[model samples]
Target: MELPRHYNENRLVLMVQEPTIIFSYWELSRGQWESLGDERFLVLRLYTTGSNRVSTVLKEVSLPPFTNDWYFRNVLPEHTYHAELGYYGPEGEFYPLLRSNKVVTPRTRPVEGMVRFLKVKTVILDTTNKDTAEEQGDSNAFWGGYSSMDLVHRS
Candidate 1:
């Protein structure tokens, strides 16, 4: 089946490819495409929200002319992100054309143990385990001193 390049509609979409990357695509209507003046250029702004629910711009990427898709990398697991398609006005003011839906990256197994896993034995520990951390509090009950390699071999 053949698909048209674009639907000629102004739209933006953001999708999480995994726990650390995002894929985004956008389309501009004919009128929106012509709206870029001589001094204006296209740009995509990636925003991330923290626990406070406040959004901040993480990265601003300059897009080549007539581009449609972008890939964002190095995003933290379990983080919220969104994107905005816009252009800078002649005076350096931002005028957004479209806003994408918010997305949260899935938490991975390794991130749960990054702090503890990077320790002496490369053991991955779940920091949020309240039950194990409460029993005697010796920090050995959760996985029984299993390093990441041990888990790999056992499984």
Candidate 2:
């Protein structure tokens, strides 16, 4: 997928800060891959509720530079939650680009009025198990593991 025009000049980072979950079928360009370092990787933060699960399946095998693509599925009992997506750089931070509240009926497309933007800083990842952290050590693994991303948003 093509990245939004605004993100072209900005740097993008993605992190899975939620507890025990797996992300599959996602690929990043050499540039995007290199943009993320240990300290900077904390810029992209996503969270989930107790016992909730989040999963991503890539539809495309390869992606080009300046591309923003996401395919996600969630399984939760009966609670609404927010999922934040955005880019973090020296300039500042952005988020709430998308949000969803659990309803009685299932949703196929993102619910309207569910998207917004917020300037945020410092994201935390609380995990349920140690194995999740161990798996994250193997970056080469097809399914990437979990990690925390703390964004420091500027005014």
Candidate 3:
């Protein structure tokens, strides 16, 4: 089996592997590569979008111009993320060459105060059966009651 050198498209992809890490891959088409001048350094940037929908760069790695993939670690859980292939301009500017799909990281833990269901059994003790309970030598009789239920029907 053979794989083509590049996808021949200018696109990027970002995905979450678990709660704290994300991976990205990209391919720049011929035109996209030629469009980048030598004025700035190429970079792969990982961003996290906050609740206000503002994207903040989490990490930026210098690219070797032909680099295709990278991994971002120590990311915060439940954060929206995306990747951008761009140039770090001389005047504190970012020239985005291509953008990746957006995704949200999974939470690391269960939500607090969430409802949970558990199986339970109720047992009633018979205080009147203490002598029989003592004869059985069961530890449950320590409370001076048999570990048996006696239901009294209200009806």
Candidate 4:
């Protein structure tokens, strides 16, 4: 008995190995490989969870003859990401052939009492209006010169 030349399903499969590592596998039939006709490159694109707009090419592996597996490492944690299998070409061009399902990396909790700093900025409000004083001597902009209590009441 001999094995089949290719499986029925030609698809890309991705899995998470660790908080910062991913593994991928794919299968391409002889007909599909011939269609590419050399200059075949497999590119993996990573996207931030829930956002199609935010993404970057994580890795690109040149397909030589019959290679179809890759291990992606050093990924960010607590983010949803997906892999795109595609062909790479001239002038930074890539055409995606297939896409894997989204995979979310595991989250690690931070230690208790983590050191965090809060920044406070100081702002000064000039109660003395030089422009009003110069223009109108003693005329105020509001009935009581726009007090903070007025702002609070308006809100």
TM-score of each: 0.68, 0.21, 0.65, 0.57
Candidate 2 lDDT by residue in tens digits, 82-140: 33433356666442222323222134355564344453333333474535433455443
Clashing pairs in 3: none
Residues 1-155 of candidate 4: C-alpha lDDT, one tens digit per residue: 99975694568888999988888888866677678777666665655554566666555666555567778788887878777777767877888877888888888776464343343333333566444432444333334334445556779
Q: Over all chains combined, what TM-score does candidate 4 have?
A: 0.57
Steric collisions counted per model: 0, 6, 0, 0
List lDDT for all candidates, in order. 0.84, 0.36, 0.77, 0.69
Give the TM-score (vs. native) of candidate 1. 0.68
Residue lDDT tens for model 3, 1-155: 99988778988999898889898888888877777755556788888888898999889899775578888899999889988888867788888888899999999887675343443333334675544544655555444322212112222
What TM-score number comes out for model 2?
Answer: 0.21
Distance (Å) between predicted and true CA of 33, model 1? 0.9
lDDT of prediction 1: 0.84
**Candidate with more favorable, higher TM-score: 1 or 3:** 1
Candidate 1 vs 2: which has more TM-score: 1
For model 3, state the Cα shift of residue 122 in Å.
Answer: 38
Model 3 quality (TM-score) = 0.65
Q: Which should have the higher TM-score, number 2 or number 4?
A: 4
RMSD of 4: 17.1
